[model samples]
Target chain A: MSGTVLTRTALGAVGVALGLYGAWLTLSRQTTAQIVSTVQYLVGGVVLNDVLIAAAALVVGVLVTRGLPAVVRAPVVVGAVVLGSTTLLAVPVLLSYGRKPDNLTLLDRDFVGGWWVFAGVVVACVAVAVVVRVRRGAGGSEPA
Target chain B: MTSTLPTQLPGPTPEHFTSRLRSPAVAARVGLWLGLSFGVCFLTGLLSHYAQNTSQPIPFPTSPSWGYRVTQGLHVITGTAAVPLLLVKLWTVYPRLFERPPSLRVRQLLVTGLERVSILALVASSIFMLVSGLTNTASWYVWHFGFRAAHYGVAWVAIGSLLVHIAVKLPVIREALLGDVDDTHSHDRATAVDQGVMSRRALLRTTWLASGTAVVLTAGATVPWLRTVSVFGIRSGDGPQGIPVNRTARAAGLGDDELGDSWRLTVTNGDQSVSLSRADLAGMTQRTETLPIACVEGWSANGDWTGVRMSDVLALVGADPESDVTVSSIQQNGPYYTVNTLQKNFTGDDRTLLALRLNGKELDPDHGYPCRLIAPNRPGVLQTKWLGSIEVQA
Candidate 1:
């Protein structure tokens, strides 16, 4: 085998070994019930993101930009993605799902307000980009 | 090149993905940073896990008091940054889902199968780690499984699969990375054209900005100066004392009775034992050290902890200054954090104190009243609040 192939095989072997060891550790350390729940979470995360989330994003990307002028398409899509991701990150805190009445320090931030401000900023930036593109008379001819 | 394979699948095929931004060049660029983030996160996470382990084959260091602070902070920051990069990477490669195998050869089928499995593991485990880790910052427990063990175990899987992925795609990655972002000669689909408003370079720039914004909005919990803009930070460096509390006395179910005048901290060696009351401890030589209460959840705050040195307390039972001591808490609720072993490195350090006061005032109940262990370069969980006893290992 060539040097490149040799290196690749070595890396693959080590990776496989490490991955198997991790799977074994996960199985051995957790209880049957815990393992079941963990597997559910692991599999569910893949399905949720790959199927639901990605599909929704695809739909929204196609639908939202279908009729829109090309000048604002990129900014709008980028803004939506940024806004969606940030909102997802802030959801746990915003919902205060884990807020303990006894512990005021946890999830004490005004996340909802913060998220709104962040969303507004993203929207304003997108709007600015669109306006600038329009002003430049580069009606989808130039790449942003 | 036309494939002989049937294209009767109902779903959208690779040809349907025509965006020039979704090329291998974009994936490779974003993936490079994503891989770096995961690499940093994985290493720091391992360090953190090892630090918190009950038995350390090699003792975790007590020097550089800000070591854990930097590491845990990097862990969260890198993990947060990976969120955007991962999303972008997935989007770039999503078209490959519909691509059919070029041939039905056995070797090709096996390679494809292995690649798909590794990718599945990588994607699933990566998502699990990030999502679970984010929820953990808020102390949210949506699942019944133990978070630490599951997170740690899955981290190994994620990193390993990522390594395999890198190995598998090294050739393509090298070619794409070496070339310009706009050069889509061989890496992009033949159907892909520059029809979108954004170029590949612009998309990458936008992704980086989004990632930076994510980090800026959340990293304030660890980087004290960023607290104002870290509006999404779980803790605002606010608590009863000058620092934030993870598990409050009330949350720990410790009533005033346990923390009342009857509290006595017992110090013990193998055959020797010494008990001291709050007043007795107060009369001892007091030392104060400003140390950051860095938590594994990645929030940290510094406080001037005034109390007797662990060395002095260990000396009461004729224990050596370098003795490893197990600090137990009066906390009855939590099982794991109720007891933490302080290595000889921590015990021998004059900076390590059984803190009686914070910021010149007595510690509030929420901040481990009576006395709590405050050691340098240790996770806040191992600080062992609400003192019960300290057992010196022979």
Candidate 2:
């Protein structure tokens, strides 16, 4: 059976998280300064997409790989890689939200470096998917 | 030990996932599109910087009045839309980033390593640029002016890496895009998604639509739309320059009108050349306007510019509106900044002129000094400063 759209369960988690974050930012009654601060945080996180742009990629990768045989699920694999990478990026923000801001995240000074490591991982995953697909094709008669 | 059957999914395990950098087609496509868009923004921004800081002029559209505004507005809008496009493009091509270096080859490893590093730089700096830019837009002042410096600095990194990306992947990009839109289509049965959903097609459509939406939203905000859905309303506030922050006036910085130079402007016309000094020119029709000087960065400010009508200057110089007039700068920097007839310059009203004052006072250094060109609804870039010469480009 085609494994398309079969991976919605995990994706649903991310979607829910994104929506919740967005809603919280929207509904919170903040002073102008507080609003500015929140907006700054939001903008800072979002603008990262211009370079690392991992969030949308993760979503698309998930959509692309949602269906496919296990042997060639390039999109789904890509999605997982991007998702994991972005999760690392979200760590600082979550830490900040949790009121336990760890200054060591280096988000302000080396944000691009941090985010790009995730992007780099995604690229690596795509290659792995290809190799696995090819090996599976070569070993057609071997295992059940 | 009674163990349940392993619930491992059939086929390749996650650990065996190969790299995408191996897929030259995907790598090349990602590299090219990303590089081009970044290049366009980088170049335009560089150009604007020069124009803003110096009195030199570039051959910008000068007619229809509102031309400069449209172009600069477009530049900002495009930059904003790039946020989403960059993300989506990276998502699609990110997989190729992981392909192993050419095994057993030193030369290939260096080449591949360089490419990977450049890609990394491009991704890293672009994220910095977008985040900083958006935060600034939102007035999220976490950092100091250092953020501005960082933005410019990262821009160079992004541009350099993007160029490398283009140099390496240009040929592949050309080939892939050579075919019609349908060529990008994939119909392989191995990767089909759900029944009514064509994934690749949907992706492309979504990308284009998102870009178009950005364009529309920006234009709507700038071009005076029947509706208003400007993202965050960056231009929603009012000051002289839409400088929403730093409102407290400085000590001893009396507003402009207090200076009261009643500056005179002189106008002269000769063959292919026109000269104007502050005195003879101001003798002509003097106009005062309180208009916001909107910038491409989505910032706006209201300044009172008092000056003679440029049309009258053109008339004295035998430069007719029927023909294009080239306005040049007095300061030694440049003479190329001139205006031509654009659609917006004709604001169905008479609000366009070369402004000479701000807030009832003579122009300041940070603002344009001596004199500068001003038109309604046009972007700040087109308003050239330091009055020098005007030539009718026949």
Instruction: Name the candidate that leads on TM-score.
Output: 1
DockQ of candidate model 1: 0.73
Off by over 4 Å in 1: A140-142, B1-6
TM-score of chain B of each: 0.97, 0.56
Go through the candidates in order and give each one's C-alpha lDDT: 0.87, 0.47
Over B301-331, each residue of candidate 2 has an lDDT whose tens digit, in order, gives 4566787666666666565543344555433
Compared with the true structure, the alpha-carbon lDDT of candidate 1 equals 0.87
Q: Determine the iRMS, in angstroms, of model 2.
A: 19.5
Model 1 steric clash pairs: none
Worst lDDT run of 10 residues, candidate 1 chain B, spans: B1-10
lDDT score, residue A3, model 1? 91
Worst 10 residues of 1 chain A by lDDT: A135-144
Error of 2 at B111 (Å): 1.6
lDDT of 1 by residue, B1-394 (tens): 2345536547788988888878999999999999999999999999999999878889999989989999999998999888888988998999988777666677877788889999999999999999899888888888877888899998999989988998999999999999888886877899888456577777888889889888999999989899999878888888886677778888888888999999989999998998888899999999989999999999988889999999998888889999888889987768787988888988999999999999999999999889989999998889888999999876
Worst 10 residues of 2 chain B by lDDT: B243-252
Query: Could you estimate the TM-score for every candidate?
Result: 0.97, 0.48
